[model samples]
Target: MRVGSTMLVRQNLTRKLSRSILLVICIGIAFFVFGVLSSFRAGFEGSEANSERLVVASKIGGNETLPLRYFQQLGGMDEIAEVTHVTRLRAHTAGNERNIIGANAVDAQSYASVYADTYDFNAEIMQAFQADRTATLVGRQLAEREGWAVGDRVNLTSFVHMTQDASRDWSFVIAGLLDGAEPTVDTNFLIVRYDYFNAALLRNQDQVNLFGIKPAVGTDINVLAETIDMTFANSTAQTRTQSETAFMSAFLEQFADVALIVKLIVSVSFGTILLIVANTMIFAIRERTLEIGVLKVLGFSGSSIMRIILTETLVLFAAGLALGFALTAAVIPVLGDALSSVVPDLYLTPKVVATSVGLAVVFAVLTGFLPAIKALRLPVATALNHR
Candidate 1:
């Protein structure tokens, strides 16, 4: 009996090929949006869970530099395990659409240790980074994009120049490539020795964009962050300190509420999809009124008719989800390198796929439900005579 009902469902679907295809396209696009948005939100969320890391920056904003003296003041504190500072510099490569990333002038010896969780630097690379003032360590993504290798010389344009007429161009040899510990690390930037940058940029001397601190184990990170911020509150350059993850979150927030925006988009897409699929199902049920009446006359129960309709809707949803997932997979390899900064480790995880499929099933049931019930409630005699 179930096999016979399944055959009827398949026949009905084959008769309405265009409508099924449209419904599949709608659901697939919705799932595609959901998958991409969820991936980006995951990156921001995971960064917040690391316990020992904190970022100290100016109270004014990220662009405002803190006095270099705070580096020593924070380093001397008993609660801190390690402290490192970085100054931001604008960097440009030769390509027209080059993803111009913000480079960092870091204290070479200790910078690697600050982000030990996200990057691994070798002894030779660290030594070279420290010894040569002209040495720059490039991230793997940037290196691949620019086709740069160790010992390769490249010229970069820095926007921070003392004089308007002075040259913005600075040259450096690629000392090493940064090995990213995770995908979320914004490895699209270059790292130059702070001392080199300080001497070179005349006006921005003795200042850093932010400081990274590692607290001692067992210390209350919240309390420590508050203490650091308070200590510098009365100073010439006041500080605002927070967990490293919070800092990244705030940094991303400056652009916009990306997750919320994505959620809103997905919501709207799904809402419209619900209407379209429900309408399609209603029209399909009406067209098969006579067929449904015949089925009832043949001793098939009303519940069986409902199940057949629900199954057909679910099949359409499943087909759409499959196509959507395939599209996502194809686009990732092309866009992954560019979007790695925002949506790190973008791929079709089992969790995302399952969530998408589950959402589709729920949508299908909802869309098919009323129509199924209506089909069942129809009087066999009336339905057969009318159509």
Candidate 2:
């Protein structure tokens, strides 16, 4: 096998350097696209799967606000383990002038109790946030990016000006950091006490965008969701509730059908690779017609000829796969930073790497099969006389 590979490398790749190089480039690009899409989907679905939480939003739409009274009502339900409400604030930091980062005003004690399963709150920080209305807790990612430490004061410019004065900037003391329980949990939110926000921005008082719910274990989550919706049915402010996974799917569907988009992209990429690789293989075999005849005359079996061709095609794919995956690994961090709000996190996991290698093997078989068949059946005399 080693001797056969040496022969193929010398007579095929070395002699046809231009064709080989072009094929490698094309294969690299195709696989790179596949790796990116797979990583995005994995990050999104993985986060949703481990969470058993539910979200209660206004029936009117996502942007509509719900009354603060709903928090008490939701908490009163026996099926719910915990409930908390939060209002979204528009805020931007230095150097991110164009991007509107998400900040939330949450009830410090209640919010901590609800998210305890997914996040660990420092006891001292929690005490500070509850004790001082101006105190805030930063997500791990935001703290690392902004170089914020305990007791550091940070000011955020809000889009909504305060009613008391036309001031847009709000300042807070960093009391603590919210650390994620798992890698999939998003740690980019800047959570502040709602009392301070409501008192500061008197214009938008006693209103929250959504309620987060945690159901008691052994409780039927879907049934509880239906019950919550039914309780508020046709009221002045109707409510809609869904599991975390369902809500994420619905939210992502607003942009595009994720499954359909993935299918179209993978299909197009592989189709292009199939044509490019097949042409390269056929040309390489045709150029080596006389060499193949000599091999057969020297007692090489037809199966051995087929093995040589298949092995050569696989080597080309392996080279491209290595380059493509390395490129994907390098690009993941930049992509994650740019799309942090949407993607949350991007990773090139071992499962994804294994899947890409399996795809390369499949490509090898498809591209090399027809050419190998031709080489196997060629008459030694006829092949020797070819131009």
Decoy 2 TM-score against native: 0.80
Poorest 10 consecutive residues by lDDT, candidate 2: 42-51
List model 1 lDDT by residue over 1-387, tens digit each: 377678988998989788788888888888877776665565544442354699999999987999999999999998998899998876665343255655788998668887777787888888878778999998886787678899998677766644233667667889999877866455666898888878877576898999999898788999999899899889889999988777876777788877678779888989998998999899999999998999899988899999999999899889988888887887766666667555545555667778887898899999999899999899999889965
| TM-score for each of the candidates | 0.83, 0.80
Alpha-carbon lDDT, every model = 0.81, 0.82
Return the lDDT, model 2, position 57: 89
For model 1, give the 10-residue run with minimal summed lDDT: 42-51
The residue pairs in collision within model 1 are none
Give model 1's TM-score versus the native structure. 0.83
The number of the candidate with the highest TM-score is 1
Colliding pairs, model 2: none
